[model samples]
Target: MGQAAPSKDEVARRLADIGPGEEREIGEGVFMTMHRLQAIQPLGDGWHRAQSTEGSFSVELPLPFNDFRVRAQATDNVEMRTHTVGGKTPGLLAWSASCLARRDGKLGPEARAPGSDKIEVKGTPPVAHSRSVDLDDMTCILIVEAQGSDPVPPEADRLRFLHSLKRTGRPAW
Candidate 1:
């Protein structure tokens, strides 16, 4: 009845349009691939938004997968909210730390905190970030953390993103 399931290599692979630094560079050393992951500004007092400039990623992962991203550009700069393509969902949770930890390749200040800061999160996925990007803030550090060997749900990944930019949201799961 259903079509033959796509192979891990198939579903995991990024679209052809996904370039080395534009979108999903599905392979090793991914930070160099997912560069536009964070190129936006604050929307409200606490909401950051990024359009699907290169389009959103929909890799078929195992568990409650990470759906999309929320920039969390500003808390006071905006309305202190998470603005994904679906605005804000009821089950959308948030992270308490930055996904830019050394574990993900960048130098994040986790020594001040206790948690691994790797941010192994879980919960329903978010919508999409946005369609317009702000290249001035060419911060693509989250790419590695998002597409790394470890398994951090997209829901949790988004949370960490929001928190780092001082955005706010309650934990869903």
Candidate 2:
């Protein structure tokens, strides 16, 4: 017989323990690879696969950071934001949409709210990367912020998470 697959809880613990500069699988065919930045430590607390309660879509997130910082009138459009935790810069503000066509411009007010100040990361200030992604039936908007001189999380990390957004085999109609 083959070895049994790891449970979800076990996967979460392993992802946390692996820290930065390492890759951990958060779900079936879903893997999160942490990138290292100067002066920043690795992240912990693992990742959880977050799905809309209505089963419209699914994505991955680091623990304790799943709260939506901003949301539209329609609950399907939302943005999950967080501060730096466990030594790792929390560079993720992932948005999910049930209908990309109907909700493209209705997500994250913070993303729409404009102006950004330069923040230091690895001793040098870099502008935060705010980007949008389209995943077939879902839409993802990613935002990474740098408060004052604090370092912004890497864009690669945000992209990784954004790309992981997938529809959960449910019709959005």
Structural RMSD, model 1: 18.4
lDDT of 2 by residue, 1-173 (tens): 53566797887686665544465655443344443322211234355555543325555544333221112233444432111111223443322222232243332433343232222233245544444554443344444445444455466655554455555663222
Q: Top lDDT: which candidate number? A: 2
> How many Å off is the CA of 28 in candidate 2?
42
Model 2 reaches what TM-score against the true structure? 0.35
Q: Highest TM-score among the candidates is held by which one?
A: 2
TM-score of each: 0.20, 0.35
TM-score of 1: 0.20
Tens-digit lDDT string for candidate 1 (1-173):
53564566764565444532343423332322333322334545444443322222111111121223223213123211112222222333321211221222222222232222232222344223311122121122222122223343465545444333321222111
Model 1 has an lDDT value of: 0.29
